[model samples]
Target: MPIFEYQCRECKKTFETLVFGNQEVTCPMCKGKNVKKLMSAFSHSSDGKFTSSAGPGCGSCSATSCGPS
Candidate 1:
């Protein structure tokens, strides 16, 4: 199960939820069903390899999205 970030429209509180196959999504605070999924940042790990989520020519990019060496 993947954890997703959500914002409650009713209470205006941000929370995390574990989403499982059509399961009901509700806010932890105020128990509000009116929630919106947020585009949260994520990271992935590669086994013993250098990875760059920023795609090619990451050295020239301003953002440092490339994983550590």
Candidate 2:
């Protein structure tokens, strides 16, 4: 039950899907077999705080900490 993110090289669309065993992955948008797995980041919360391996804030934004500190 491992969920992985992928980016379709043909359409340049990014998406996530559940993968099991040695099954092949296809782009949900264009159904293209030419896809590449992307490196994903993980996050968790404890003591009423949110933290991520991508550091503070969303990776695409400049805000410091996307959750309560």
Candidate 3:
């Protein structure tokens, strides 16, 4: 089974679901059927470094400088 993330359009709630097969998906918060699957990031650590395609800062800072110069 794969874990899928979904965001509710009705209540604006985010949640995850473990799907085994083709089935109907609904928001757990408001039980609304209007939901959209979100493209989440997968992370892995190798050679003592963390890398991801989500870029740096994760939206914390908008500055161009990264770390102490």
Candidate 4:
């Protein structure tokens, strides 16, 4: 089983769920079946500390320069 974050399409609410085999997912707020999985941010733990994949803003951009884009 894996946890996934979802945004309800009907009520516009955000929620998380632990999905199992063939399990139906729905919003806990409005019980809406229409939902979309969000592009979740990733993180990792090292030496008992946590770090995010998208470090600080650091005025950095992958496809474009740090200027106004």
TM-scores of the models, in the order given: 0.56, 0.58, 0.55, 0.54
lDDT of each: 0.70, 0.75, 0.70, 0.66
Which prediction has the highest lDDT against the true structure? Answer: 2
Q: Weakest 10 consecutive residues, lDDT, candidate 3?
A: 44-53
Candidate order by decreasing TM-score:
2, 1, 3, 4
Which of the predicted structures, 1 or 4, would earn the higher lDDT when compared with the native?
1
Error of 2 at 54 (Å): 26
What digit string (tens of lDDT, one per residue) describes model 1 on residues 1-69?
487778899989987678998988988879889999887524543342333344544544566555354
lDDT of 4 by residue, 1-69 (tens): 387778899998976678888889989988879999876523531332222344443334454344343
What is candidate 3's lDDT per residue for 2-58, written digit by digit as tens?
877788999999877876788878899999999998876235313323333436544
lDDT, model 1: 0.70
lDDT per residue for candidate 2 within 1-69, as digits (tens), equals 497878999999987778999889999999999999987523421332223465766655677777456
Q: Which candidate leads the pack in TM-score?
A: 2
> For model 4, how big is the CA root-mean-square deviation?
11.5
Candidate 2 off by > 4 Å: 44-69
Model 3 TM-score on a 0 to 1 scale: 0.55
Q: How far is 53's C-alpha from truth in model 4 (Å)? A: 25
Alpha carbon lDDT at 5, candidate 4: 74
